[model samples]
Target: MSGSGAIVLNETVHQPTRLRIMSMLVSVDTTDPLAYGFLQNHLELTPGNLTTHLRKLEDAQYVAITKEFHGVKPRTWVQATAAGRHAFAEYLTNLERVLGVRARP
Candidate 1:
């Protein structure tokens, strides 16, 4: 809650698909990024759809994306930035406050 007694939500992290994406990324080890294909399959998003959402997250500096080659195949990996992790935590806190639920330790 803010000083004005209004619940403010982060629009960037609040979007449904992006929120799910953040949740998955935040759960993984920092050193081990998720593969693009895995996120697409798990989230049931098409390639173009996933890429658009990823671009938005990347533009916000909330996620880092890396493209590389594994033999003759190209691979893309995604990881949440430190700032992103903090933002996601704050978002959850605000959401909990709005729902009158206590946050977990």
Candidate 2:
């Protein structure tokens, strides 16, 4: 697909918040799941807004959400799945195609 210049967009990951979410996740290691609170704070999104967007990502199987108990407290962590990683990479390629920006090797 590289050099073919075909612009293929991943609609699931194309939403503004979703795109931002994938960008952040791609920057971190796969095993390093982010806390729910951290995402809400960093994205500046309300709890309801985050929840809705997360549900969409989860439904697409692009993100995996884990809920565990920290003693009496409930903790939720989110990470991108392999599928998400691939989708994000493809999204970047599409963005580059749209911008006519060639990626450096």
Give one clash count per candidate, in the order shown.
0, 0
lDDT of 1: 0.94
| Runs of candidate 2 exceeding 4 Å displacement | 1-6
Worst 10 residues of 2 by lDDT: 1-10
- Tens digits of per-residue lDDT, candidate 1, 1-105, equal 568899998999999999999999999987879999999999999999999999999999989999999999999999999988998999998899889998568
lDDT (Cα) of model 2: 0.90
- Give me the displacement of residue 36 in model 2, in angstroms: 0.3
> Which candidate achieves the best TM-score against the true structure?
1
Query: What value does the lDDT take at residue 46 in candidate 1?
Result: 97
Candidate no. 1 TM-score: 0.92
Shift of residue 3 alpha carbon in model 1, Å:
4.4
What TM-score does model 2 achieve against the real structure? 0.90
User: Candidate 2: which pairs clash?
Assistant: none
Model 1 error, position 57 (Å): 0.7
Pairs of residues clashing in candidate 1: none
